[model samples]
Target chain A: MTNAPEITGETDIAPPVSSTGIVAWMRERLFSSPLNIIMTVLCGLLVIATLPPFIEWALIKAVWISPTADACRAARGGACWAFIAEKHRLILFGLYPYDEQWRPLLAALVNIALIVASCMRRFWNIRLLYIWGIGLVLISWLMWGGVLGLSYVENTKWGGLPLTLILATFGVGFAFPFGIVLALGRRSNMPAIKTLCIMYIELIRGVPLISLLFMSSVMLPLFFPEGFSIDKLLRAQIAIIMFAAAYIAEVVRGGLQAIPKGQYEAADALGLSYWKKTGLIILPQALKIVIPPMVSLFIAMFKDTSLVVIIGIFDLMNATKASLTDTAWKGFAVESYIFVSIIYFVFCFSMSKYSQQLEARLATGHKR
Target chain B: MKKVKATAFAVLAMVAAGSVGMAASPALAGATFDAVKARGILQCGVNTALGGFSAPDSKGEWQGIDVDVCRAVAAAMFGDASKVRFSPLTSQARLTALQSGEIDMLSRNTTLTLQRDAAIGLNPTGVTFYDGQGFLVPKKLNVKSAKELGGATVCVQSGSTTELNLADYFRAQKMEFKPVVFEKLEELVAAFFAGRCDVYTSDASQLASGRALQAPNPDDYVILPEIISKEPLGPFVRHGDDQWHDVVRWSLFAMIEAEEYGITSKNVDEMLKSNDPNVKRILGVTPGMGKALGLDDKWAYNIIKLVGNYGESYERNVGSGSKLNLPRGYNAQWSKGGLLYAWPIR
Candidate 1:
């Protein structure tokens, strides 16, 4: 039995070449059982039935550029992309001065670059924090231009893609540390600190973000002393930070709780201080365990920035909505909404991919 | 722009909303006029998207009747209409934005009502457009009258005055109708277009604007003749700033006055040479009116030059000159047998 098989390299020759490209894989999985085959065939037929007419309606016969709504309504029955072409500027930058739109364009680019940089494995160190901090400062200067010899654009005029990025990036960035503090406090032995953290987290989390935004816009003025005015953007920022912090606290707490007690005990045995024990020994592992959920929370926060429209902050969604008011491009909301959806999807999908890559990279030697 | 809405729902009354301005503001808080002057750009709150009311044009310039009110205020304050920055506010957020000083004035087609003025802390500058709640339905429905509709599903904005008015109208007419309410106007419009509801109810002006702009085929819809609620839509500001309120009120009154005097934008320069004290006062050649309003003597001149009179702004945005082609009806001047009457510019 031991000598039955020859210990030759050629004996391990390529196994039978069973057709194994994507097509074969699809055939094996999608058409494996009768039920699966039937389902796949039905789906294929459905797509076949719907796809061409959809393509014709959405692209081939679509009007790319036209002067008026009637021009779009003429001849070909398809989407009027002319609406988007005419209104794209308003949707991209809101009411920002046409001459100085480059400032917002660059600000949005810088933010996107910073987010991309942060997503890289090499930038996962404290250097990432520095990059983000400096990047945000630069973006702020770019957007609210009273410095660097740039023409001043008031915060009210700052809107569209840049506004959405500012709110989401700042909201998530500010939330991470604030969330960590709340999480640590919730886990602390000190009763007062723990209770305070619990109260804040519960209070903010209990309410919808819309109310927080409303209070910031509406009720906040009543609380302020006369003669002092907080900027509307700043008020909304504070609301977003507070709201996101509460949700992030709950997420971070879950991570902190997952850390084994043995890790803390070991750090304590080594005469480590509480901060060192948590920060060095426990937090790294706990945070690693939670990267997936944390990124999911981040994605959710990014999407939530659209809600600022309710408060009159002309973010991307608001700008898109504002563009639809033009009589020249009325009754073509589907095209506009789809384009906005694609914009949102690109950011979210990248975040998801980055989270997956991070999870793989973090697996390392900590299998236990 | 930041507090959570759940906590907000609990404290709906903004307790000192009305009284705080009346009782506490004059001591030191009436700063909107100064703020507008200092900022150099009057922050005017307008509708996020209302056809013929306030909406951004393709080039990102603000347009429409409500927007003209904002331009008038800016011109009155800064002697330049372009010195205004518009904040596109939602119906729900407009009053809050004004009361909280997020905007110096709201020209967002808001209806003047006792509850709004007293409870929400807004002082109506003046009525800009006399509108009324009405119904819009597909022509195929063959419904000649709003009263004819029984068992029809009516779409109304959830928090809008139209919801209550629709209910009242159907009840008063002894008609059975289902109501479909949506939070966003976009959703409501889409629901109507998709045939989810038989009739869409709003102020009649909006119904016409929606027909001309939002409808796939403008000819497919018909606005019903019945006008239910009296919606005297206008610009407003926080109650505390009487100086700002006066400026807003009179600035609007200036437009009406200009229309009354027949001082068209085209003839404004020629009218400046008129010996009539009325034209002189309106064009600011009389001097005292502007000084009384805490602005330069050229304030009304700037308004006429930059934003045009009530009649011009109306026809350009919502009436004959616009796609809506709506009849002036109640919006016509009192001299023309409509409700628009102006206080004489003495």
Candidate 2:
């Protein structure tokens, strides 16, 4: 070797072009073998086939600012975004009086703000409860508007995104604590308590949500005295709460079962009472283990709010449907639905990403 | 164990007592009327959204022929058309809402039938809109008549009389058809428009609505002339509430009777000076009619003045003035060769 190079301090020649750069990288990762080459070509061909048509339909030929549906119709096969533009107010605020829609808008914003604040670790304290209580009262005031210089709006007039948020937020807020109690009752030493909890959970879980809604909406009125009917929104909210509580209890029980027996024994060895043991030791770990599933359940319930349309409650999905009934702007259901689905996706995806972040952040003792 | 048993017994007793206290009396004739007056607003059940039948307009005001029926009833009862609140009900919940007294009356587009009237404890007030099953086909198909729809694929909404009528029509004709049924109206209409089906069948009014509103080009689809079944859509109330039924019934009849007598919203004040004895009797210029119906002397006048006659409402909502543009063929007055024969106000 000393003889070949004459001890010259020279860099080695660059590697072959086929083994580096984007071309080399593509060759190695995508075209390394015959199967890989075929798969890459096929996938590329699929993208080529679908992407342009979708892009053209969604954007290139889409009508954005047409005053009448005729302009949208003239575009033929393109998306009619002008329908959404025309009906956005109706789809967002529902049958709330048009002049006073600002109230529902304000209420929705207040709710969103509270939800955002609740997500922050800095606000995870008793103060958060106070904030939520105040926020809810304010939301009710804005929606009902019987006092404080605001004109009154009936609850029946409420619809759209505000109604959806109210249903989902209040449903989970009350159900979470109720569910924890139910989970505890199921594991209680008292036979009666355990049996009652089991019966409630099983009965609720056995039936579909639609039947529960039907019972609440259609049958409940028949049971009540004439002229004593409950508010439709309240009845639906109760149904959602009951339905969600049963599922949440089951999920919490799964988390409770996951906790090691050693941990319970350790808590007992520390002279902790039953309540203290649960509150200080068992629940924290159990609930932590269930954050992902809990978030998943929340995401599901958020979407399930759409089912209220069957009972004719004008939540966001129903509002969109009602807007479609406008003969002036019909046949653009695909655009309308796509807009709503994107809204749902944004909220659900945000919840999912936040849960992942939360899991990571709360992974203190469990991390490798 | 003893304490738990005692508590359970107590809870059961309380529930039983509560239900007994709230138990409904066999609905008396004027229960709904009294309840509506006490509540200060007539709670009327209507379709959540069926275009010209019952739907909220852009300003969030309930606008439709069904909604006008409710307003007419309110005007008759309270002398104020605005004194009505609408409960937008799905087709499934409409009857239940009326029966439970949650709604004072149901002006939803419910087709009157023997089963609904006899078995379900409901009574039809009167026919508000006379509809019938019809077919919709694309203009490209050049389908001149529904009879020619042999070996055709038809799109129809499931769990509706529309589906049954489609089957019956095909069976009677001895024609073969592939039915593409969907649970949703939107999906069924989309299937028809997408060329998945050769024809779409539903109520004629709905077909016209779908064509006028939903067709990419309104002129591209045509509703055939053939009607296959009777769909006498009307207002209905609980069977036991006969006085309430009469009030609701006469509210609609007053609108029709007013139209027949040539009384309109614009001419009602001038018609107060009408020389006709029928007009004088109906306008409450004579008092016995109101006393018989247990309403104000000016009840009929209030209805005509506030909500207008049936013809005016029809033309304004679903006829030439609106997007639906449904012809008032069978809905026209009896003297005009249509079937709308209002019973005498007296």
- Among all candidates shown, the one with the greatest lDDT: 2
True contacts kept of each: 0.56, 0.54
| Best candidate (score: DockQ) | 1
Model 1 quality (TM-score): 0.91
lDDT tens string, model 2, A284-312?
Answer: 99998899899999999999988999899
Q: Write the per-residue lDDT of candidate 2 for residues B1-346, one digit (tens) a residue.
A: 3432343344335334542112232242347777777878998999999888888766667888999999999999999999988999987777667766788789999999887777556788899999999999988898899889999999999988788998999999999999998988888888777788899999999899888877767788888999999999999888675778889999999999999999999999999998899999899887789878889989999999999999999998899988788888899999998999999988
| DockQ value of candidate 1 | 0.43
DockQ of predictions, in order shown: 0.43, 0.39
The models' CA-based lDDT, in order, is 0.83, 0.87
Best candidate (score: TM-score): 2
**Per-residue lDDT for A142-235 in model 1, tens only?**
8878888988888887778888999999898898899999999999999999999999999998889987987787677645544466988999
Candidate 1's C-alpha runs over 4 A off are: A1-19, A365-368, B1-40
